[model samples]
Target: MAVYRIGEILRMKREALGISREKLCEMSGEICSPQTLYRIECGKVKVKRETYQQLMSCMGQLPERSYASIIVPKNQYLSIKSDIYDHLVFGEFEKAEEKLLLLEQMMDRSYPRNRQYLMKYKATLAYKLNKIDAEEYQRILVEALRCTIPQWDEIDMAEWPYNEQEMEIIFDILHTYHALNLDEKYLDACLKLKMNIERHYMDDDYYVTWKNTVHAIISWIISNRHQYEQSIEYCENGIEQLKKYRIVGNVNRLVYDIFWCTRQKYIESNLPEKEQAPCNRQLAQAYYLSVAQNLQSQSEFIRKKVKQFDIKELFFL
Candidate 1:
């Protein structure tokens, strides 16, 4: 007998009947995930009263009509949050989407951050898959940001600092603006987010990852405004941070951004041969780095830019 509490009874009954957690979840119409059910059975999380009742009924156990005082553990919650992020970063979109569904069932609704992450991931996947247009993506992200930043639209991003989750939402916002070529918004956002990063620097693994991501993004943001020197500085900073943290996810893109800015600087300014040499070399290095990273899309993008701009100097140099 799993004699811990009322929650444990669900486990005991389910086991005695030989119904696995997945089976129970399916039988219960997936009102909760297998992990959620396991946590509930272990008294590790508090589900809604209705959810508890439905799950109990699925186990052929009559409800006691009493409240279940279960609460999900901190570590368990963090673990799931990290897992979802890992899935997203690793390009496992389907897995990430599925986990988001499970998390929606399992996570406590009272925590605003839970909803925030859920909304952000949902928006990200939808936009990535072309299921939603730019407006919809921005709308969902703004709502997600509103979960934590009530005055998100009116607030000055640099005026206040944000935590990890808020920064994550902002990162998505940055991506959206850049993709849509909303230069005014992108530049404004870049400055604000940069200030926030400086204000709240944590020694967390998650924080480090976001920091590197921001660095890569803001580099291009700076470059777009014809600030190539500053942009390359930001890119170099991103690369150094990646080395310090041993994170390889964005190193190639960071290098690409560096070349992007440098090549633009040389072409627009028509730098002397001495200066153009570095720019041409950087362009070649960027193309090779994209190939080395096995990112066909990025490599192709560089090739297109090279031909489009008649930057044949890269091939010769």
Candidate 2:
């Protein structure tokens, strides 16, 4: 019964970690009053979507959307959506489709926001199966997002209260555009994300992940112009911010980017190998972290780069 029963699970996790409601609320940047959290944990009230996610993130939970929000206010809908998401995540497309059909059968189709949410999952599944190209996937998501904010394309995002659901849709659109190598659109999305995060996601782990991504994208765009040192500066800034937030997953990737940029910068300057050893060592440390985390793909990619660069003496370095 993959139903989240989010309230119960949240309460259990909180207590298991010996966290009180007041302290958890404080960790969430006071997004909800302690009273509200108590009511939610007691199952006396349905929680807002973003509020619960914020608390969960603060509590060190996975920061991905795994269940439906309270917007639909139906347990059956939430359960089915959770199942669909899990199936999709685990590469069980056929089972995911079955669950999606079950969800479609029960979901109310009149509310536009709810409608867009459904379309979002559908487009994602289609894109995952290669039924649609990145541009088409982006087009579908943008249209869905416009259902809520008709001026999404033109409006300054800072003018509105940030909505996680909408932001997730925009991220989906950005992911597709990034894959398509639509640099202008990708840069615009990253900038909008940076503005939104700065304004709303105060002191949460999600903020660290999102901010790091924005920094990395900005660095990439600068690197494309051959501003390698400038790119390294952005990556280093991102690394420091990630450390300050006490997050780990994305830090090594930033280190890798820094190593990449420094290599390019040195090569472009005709620098001696002695000048390059530090970045090479930085590259080795990032590789070690990837392996420690069991991130096989990233570790393998880094290992291939070590070979390509003939990075000898990494074992001793």
Candidate 3:
């Protein structure tokens, strides 16, 4: 059903412009009928992609663009794009490719932005298939990044066409960069990912998970660079945030990350080898705690071991 608010907005805009129904139809090149416009204004029928495009143009709302031929209808495009996204995420390359071909056919080749998004998906597929070398993949990423989210500060993802799906895809590319150990790219990607997550905070499970994942990745990167203290801090903050949000996803991994960072710093501390055993014991206890919390059957036994070894005191220490 047509939303009444949309009808009201259309009526108000049309009246404010002092454009009669006949003049509006004339202005719209008569692509939509006057009766259809009346139905839209009365909320009798739902507004369609073409009708909305034309009506908005008549009201000087939609800017003129050369991508006019790329009309696959909004709903169909969204459905197909969603299917493609699902297939790509789940490693269903052949299915994703099939749908991608249809999506590409629906796009305007004249539009550079269209090709940039396609290149991102293509680069992602190529990377997954091991067809492109890491350098080539990174180059493709650089190229795609040029066009995606240009002027990130000036633009709002929510206001973008397609609800910023392209921007989300760019985040996937950043994740791949992190996975590849492309340290040079981490600073930019992490900063942007942080900003993106902050701006689009949905207060939902997925957002929480992704935010924690990014923090964990950043922690891992920082630790590899021998910044153990910062790594521990990031891990601690992430674990606490997850707990505060009541997110039960395996936070043990992050706690173990802290343990690993602590172990690294201990190795660098130059303490007597005998004295290091206490720290090693604490590290082992941390690992055991992670395993116990992760597995129900092991939790009871690990709890007993923790008490036997006085590991609970290690927590306070």
Candidate 4:
């Protein structure tokens, strides 16, 4: 069993309600000492079956097994999340929508941590599908932010895999706010993203994936603003990071972003009309050729993404 997950679920639920450890013990009729409760919540000691039942019953939950047993297996949860992201990357919106529904159906609301992840993913998927308007997107994000337990210890977050998903959410917010021309909110999101990156203090040195993901988010966020030079730099940096810890899907995404940024920069350039037109055409042609070459060596799933782009109309310039 994932002791950390079990403890995090318990702690997040209790903290979300502003219930103190002493109050939790009192509510459970002091069935376990406060020190013991602390140990369980810290994942230093596993709660006994009876103790688990007693504590949960006090919290108004009645499960057939221990809280840990009711969780979706970590591997299965990760697989579902990864599959949804892959579908999105490949422009398989229909498949992404289907998998997201399966994920929602599989989610356990009793676990607030899972709910946090679900809300973020659902909001992103909804935006991608055009199922939510800008107002609805902001509303959903506000609600999602309000529910995250503020007191969660850094230790727990560092232990969790895919920590960069938080940065991705900020990127989504930055993009949305930019579209709405909400400069204040966009700047706030950018600052939050910076803080998030700086505060990540993992015990282990093997965090290449986290670093790559952060760079990718930075690249994508700036790309939305047509800040091509900075965006391209971040994209190149991210590509190098991915090279160090190569994942085909991630590499494909960074390259795609880089291509789009390059095309955007070309279109937005202030060169002489003659130079601008030729430059834009050259960039678009190169982008198409690069994508075609990359997809040609991949599976049909990836090749299908090529159909989504039309180089001729991609840059109005």
lDDT of 4 by residue, 128-169 (tens): 789888767866765564344233332232222223334355
- For TM-score, the strongest prediction is 2
Error of 4 at 205 (Å): 8.5
After aligning candidate 2 to the native by TM-score, how far in Å is the CA of 314 from where it should be?
6.4
- Please give the lDDT score at residue 62 for candidate 1: 44
| Residue-level error in angstroms, candidate 2, position 236 | 1.6
lDDT-based ranking, best first? 2, 1, 3, 4
lDDT of 3: 0.65
TM-score, every prediction: 0.57, 0.66, 0.48, 0.49
TM-score of 4: 0.49
Least lDDT summed over 10 consecutive residues: which range in candidate 3? 62-71
- Residue 257 miss distance in model 3 (angstroms): 1.4
Tell me the TM-score of model 2: 0.66
lDDT of each structure? 0.71, 0.75, 0.65, 0.60
lDDT for 105 in candidate 4 is: 81
Question: Residue 264 of model 2: what lDDT?
Answer: 91
What is residue 156's positional error in candidate 3, in angstroms?
A: 11
- Clashing residue pairs in candidate 1, if any? 45-70, 45-71, 45-72, 46-70, 46-71
